[model samples]
Target: MSKVLIIFIKNPVAGKVKTRLAATVGDTTAVEVYKNLLHHTQNITHLMAADKFLFYADFLQREDEWPNEQFIKHLQKGNDLGKRMHHALEQVFLNKYKNVLIIGSDCFELTAAIIEEAYLVLEDKNIVIGPAKNDGCYLLGMKNPQPCLFKNVSWSTSQVLQQTISICTREHLNDCLLPTLTDIDDENDLSVEQKIYFKLKKSAQ
Candidate 1:
């Protein structure tokens, strides 16, 4: 029952985070939006019943919103998204964590209940995926370190989820799919509430 949740977040820099969304909203506003998503993620995960690991895409922030007491922070070590996720999972698995899950800060639709469902699914299945629109995924969880899942796969494309599923099928892994969720990557992906919130944040700034 030793489970670990690996949350991948970028440093809240104006031009570095949420670049895709920034294309339309501008960098400062995109940073504001990403910060909101980070706070939402923190609120949902802080009370979960698992050891939380916060993987920073850039440098680690020891005095930021993610409290040191709650999140074990680490710097991401790979050049690509797939490799970084693989490295994080490998690190946690090496520590003998029975269940390991990875998530990013882009999914506003992701909630603690969905995370709990992924862990519950993993109790019976080898892999669990929370599929996102356009062939991405909001979450990926597994009981063991499966390097093949990350090998030769296209990262950040419309084929990601399908390619991973194909890998699972080829490996004969028992996999489960949770409800589909959306990762807020583009301007069109924003909800009404998020849009209003962003405007208010911009006005306040």
Candidate 2:
């Protein structure tokens, strides 16, 4: 069975994306930053994975803007963050892939090796989580579709990782955790990590 990778991204429209960061960096800058993040994510995924898809917030009107012609681009359809992710995974599993890995664009430390490691862990574990320093997760992978792992959980909060762990425990699922990494979400979160933020800014430019 083929391994699949689903990249989750929002429309990088000014004043619509990254609202928290827009409060400090302005809408225009936030949009530009989000675009750069998408570019970086696409680059890394293209280099590492063979089967990839873009789980976009909005449907793409122009095909030229998207990278791979083989990539299956689909609009996310769900009420909340958790539901959207769950729905995306369900779709991927329905495609007959053996393992599916989903990642967000905010994480700078995410690399091809990290993704490959997650795929490797799926052989023995039911779920593999790449935890973020902010107590969230950058990546989530599973061998099968399991919506219970995402049900009724608080998203975009510091307790996100903990809540996911609780869900896994309750379901008796075997889970593997990777080393913690940082993700750029808000101004305060960036302030403490000036070096990484500036590095990303420079790379974006």
Which pairs of residues collide in candidate 2?
Answer: none
lDDT of 1 by residue, 1-205 (tens): 4989999998999988889999998999999888888999999999998999999998988998888999999999999999999999999999999889999888888899999999999999999999998679889999999999999899999899999999999999999999988888888899998898898888888
> Quick one: how many clashes does candidate 1 have?
0
Q: Candidate 2 lDDT, tens digit per residue, 53-131?
A: 7888876644645664756788888888898998888887887887889999987678888999999999999999999
Q: In model 1, where do residues sit more than 4 Å from their true spots? A: none
Per-model TM against the reference: 0.97, 0.89
Model 1 weakest lDDT span, ten residues long:
196-205
Q: What stretches of model 2 exceed 4 Å from their correct place?
A: 191-205
**Model 1 TM-score?**
0.97
